[model samples]
Target: MLSDHDFLRYSRQIMLPLCGELGIKTLAKARVVVIGAGGLATVVAPYLVGAGVGYLRLCDDDIVSVSNLPRQWLYSPAHIGQQKVRVMAAQLKALQPAAQVEAIPEYADNSNLCRLMSGADLVLDCSDNMTTRQLVNAYAMDAGVALVSAAAIGLHAQAAAFQPSLCGPHGNHGCYRCLYPIDSQRAGNCQSEGVLGPMVGMAGCYQAALALRILLGDPNVPWSQLWRLDSTLGEHQLLRIQPDPSCSVCGHVSHSNASSDDSSIPNSGV
Candidate 1:
């Protein structure tokens, strides 16, 4: 059902083994929700739109500032006081007019998360703080939608994909809560710790890749595996995340049968 323009515009990716015309069409019909319009969303938005995602809902309550210019590529000096999602939506429209990008100038909190995430095929948690990430993860779990999350600060970055359906009684995937249950323990945000521009950009790129793979149903996508990168050292590490039956967010009575042995998490260099 691709128009001539769409086919021609996306022919390069359509010819790939993993992403044939079917994959491109799948992407064209996908509805995605992105949390946070800062560093990661700036990079993730353009890629999703350019690759033909049918719709994208961007949620953020922040405004552009001089400090964000180094990593957030969507804004400029003229957009200093403007809302982040508004600026991002305009730029994304310019990238691909056919894609429907909705800008919600609000944070993803208890009041509006259900409305924002309803009917989404996938959710990207690019939030800076643990509180928002935990909230988004719970929403995604209840909705049975996949969540791709990433973070960057002080030259180190991490990205992962989670599907709540894959974490029940017979499932093996882990949710965001399982990874970092205590919000007080996870601190270093980009604002206070400082981050290199390319560091967040790299994390964003990984997030985009994971999002696309999930949308395309790529069997090789590293579900629930945390990818860690050190930009300074040019090193990459992959950590397998185990499902926690005792997890406050995704745990259930039947899930208690899952292995809770946290002793042997496989680690490998990439």
Candidate 2:
């Protein structure tokens, strides 16, 4: 039951054909967990809260720094040196008082992953590091929760959704590990590679869109597809991906049900 204020607050969204009163209720019933309260989370958390997601759990061990001000819009100059999860949770609560927001100011590892993902309907990977991303992917897949993963470096950004049901049918529907196998060699980090602020925002917006679609149960969304945006070249690419047959993470009979093992990496066909 939406309050009078809620109906008015979400009237425009509810009026849409795909998001009527029922869809709004669904959104209100969905629980989402977001890893890394930085770049992507800045944009994603607000939209989900504004859309009336029932519960939002944010995880991040880092504190707000001056350098993050350009892209992390949730925090202000005054919030510098404050814990990211705490600040973000406060901001989200401010936006939607009716919604529940929790802050976990600790790194999400195997130990806390299960508890973090316990009741979540969906999870968003907004972390910048590959290790954290892989952990989130594995945990979400193991928990049978849908995952929306996004990454950005420089002017390049990629966003994808992984639904457990889509993993077995096609090799294209894979997890982060399938796309980038963990080896001894490490790739570029945001600190070393440098990232454009808008690029992160662009990726974050796409992540939010996918999360909304999953929550609203919109069938038209291609959940297995990956969307790549290269603002540097002014190009956008959409690739339909299938699961990998021999993926280390998703393969093996014992872990056959693990959706995290699926992976696909987007490269510009241009």
Which is the leading candidate under lDDT? 1
Q: Which stretches of candidate 2 lie over 4 Å from their true place?
A: 169-172, 183-185, 253-270
Clash pairs, candidate 1, are none
Q: Per-residue lDDT tens digits of candidate 1, residues 108-155?
A: 876788788888999999888877887787767766778999999999
lDDT of 2 by residue, 182-251 (tens): 7322655576688889988989999999999989998887776789997878999988765666655554
Score candidate 2 by TM-score against the native.
0.90
| Candidate maximizing TM-score | 1
Off by over 4 Å in 1: 253-270
Give, for candidate 1, the lowest lDDT window spanning 10 residues.
261-270
TM-score of candidate 1 versus the correct structure, residues matched by position? 0.91
| Alpha-carbon local distance difference test for all models | 0.85, 0.80
Q: Which 10-residue span in candidate 2 carries the lowest summed lDDT?
A: 261-270
